[model samples]
Target: MSTGPGILAPVTALGAATLRLLGEMGAMFLFLADGLRLIFASPKQIPKILNQVFVIGSKSLFVILLIGVFTGMVLGLQGYYTLVKFGSEGLLGAAVALSLIRELGPVLTAIMVTGRAGSSMAAEIGVMRITDQIDALDVMDINPMAYLVSPRIAASLISFPLLTAVFDVVGILGGYVTGVTLLGINEGVYFYRIQTSVEMADITGGFMKSLLFAVIVATVSCYQGYFTHMRRDGVGPEGVSNSTTSAVVLSCVFVLVADYALTSFLL
Candidate 1:
């Protein structure tokens, strides 16, 4: 009898949600532009940027190594068995190297760093917002965006590529250990295939993905934290927690989505 109102209710909710998402996305892009624009506003920012690099890059090194090795080993094991069916186990090296360098290296590095550093960014900024520390910086004309967000953005840009390189190298070695040393595949063939099959284009494409992911993770993480106080779902400590959770989740989702988009273009 009242189907009109029922249907309209769901439609209105969906429309409102879509509008809100679009608004938030617009705001986030502006936030990223502003943060990047102010990255070099002062020479004194050098130390801050370096500090963030250490935080986001050096600190995450061990986890990246551990994950990279295991992933490569798994790839080697699987690729060997799969290729052996066709008597092409020698291609294992090429398969693992290409997979890690062109895809997994950038994607996994970004996701891991996002988990470690992105969440921290959101939590730290969210805490600052809730505690009025950000306000104090504004009162002092310190430019909170420049002071807090820009360094992080700069650091992510620096860190993501380097970490991806490390992941690729370590993953290749791991694959070597499994495919050649343990699996008894020809070491020369393994390395030769990797060298011959992987091109400069693939390497550059992976770096490009890392750079884009760096921007996405940094901007989304900082934006979530900066606007924590404005969240409708929570406030104060709860708001900080929600912001941190949202930052990690959104960064990962954005990373994967960006990865697919980049792959399509690069391929």
Candidate 2:
């Protein structure tokens, strides 16, 4: 059978795309399974998970707080000026609260956490893979996935939302300070505006997005690290480095994409 180039190109492209998606889907399922297993396995792992969560979540609190403060301040400054031009400066609180709670809070926190902890996880695990520590776990009859991947995932699940909550509080406070102290708006007005304008849905949606971002960050980082085959001749350090870079890049991209999709569906 002879096939023209035009006849096979479309089929080949379709097949490649399908296979790529399937690979991604399979990896996602595996990541989910590993996370569930780790969550359900030993009770002793809970303390470890908490410790990791503290390291990942609590440790990042200062950064989140700083970012939230500046973000809210800048948002307030700009929003107040813009609203003033429209003779609606009173809506500054509503604008800052809504934007932070619905969009900036979770997304920015996710990006920061991914850069801080996600990259570290990938590099650490990638080095372990290169050193055959993962293989040694196989020899010892221990599940590498359970031992390494699960804890990070569980930690992320616990931490990301906590971080989001912190982001929410700090950001609101920042906006309040900027509005009342810096811009000469009434404190009661700013507080009351946000209190009434901010809906439960806004908080819940941000929390949900944070949770999803956590999972995506953990899974993408772990997958890249875990699947790195360092023994492939010239692809040792280079492969591991590439995996680390890919993990960070992919996690950031996935977080933004998921944020948009989730917002569309939920709100």
Candidate 3:
């Protein structure tokens, strides 16, 4: 007859698991619906979308450039040493180009964006949630999802590819400098090798991955922030903090997973 504790334990565990799964599913559906709406309602918000794209894409150029340069330099230095041991120093350009275009560019850019812009987006939305601004938008007959979330998703879609291209170009320049100037590789030979080695497939693969990463980052950040309960009786500062942390961690994990999946399928 004293089965109260055992029964209560299982019931509580099930209830908690159910609630967590429901919350995650709800957030995912909201994000999907938001993305679909943006895709269908495109022409109306072109200007706003463009503004966001510019802000998201252009504002990130400096950091991407810096990372690209360093990445290229390091690649060249490392590749050169490795190839020299095998008398294959001429493959330096191809090595750098392949590495940058295939892996490092997308992954590094995503990590940086997730850490910088993603965190910012989550924090900003968290603040709005806590302040009831999102609710006020609903009361004013404005679709908060359309107004707040769509622009970001659109901006990310447009910005990520551009950022990837920038990363590619800057990284190549970095490799060129280190290889030609420091390693004494002939400039013409280095450029020619890169031109021949890198193909459209590599470029396309990187861009596709970047686009997916952008979507993942934007969606995760928005979801975390939007679902964050800041009410007095619900999620408070601690919850918001957890949301922000989870957003970054989840975005990173998805980026890496997506990268591998895309690479496998594409290549």
Most lDDT-accurate candidate: 1
Which prediction has more favorable lDDT, 2 or 3? 2
Off by over 4 Å in 1: 1-3
When superposed on Cα atoms, how far off is each prediction in RMSD? 1.1, 2.2, 3.3
Q: Please rank every candidate by TM-score, starting with the best.
A: 1, 2, 3
What is the per-residue lDDT of model 2 for residues 97-176, given as tens digits with 9 covering 90 to 100?
99998999999999999888888888888889988999999999988877888888999999999898888788888988
Superposition error at 207 for model 1 (Å): 0.1
Cα misplacement distance, residue 8 of candidate 3 (Å): 14
Show model 3 residue runs off by greater than 4 Å: 1-26, 42-44, 230-234
- Cα error, residue 192 of model 2, in Å, equals 0.6
- In order of appearance, the predictions have TM-scores of 0.98, 0.92, 0.88
Of the candidates numbered 1 and 3, which has the greater lDDT value? 1
Error of 2 at 188 (Å): 0.9
Candidate 2 versus the native: TM-score? 0.92
- Candidate 2, poorest ten consecutive residues by summed lDDT: 227-236
Residue pairs clashing in model 2 are none
What are the per-residue Cα lDDT tens digits for candidate 1 across 40-78? 799989999999999999999999999999999999999
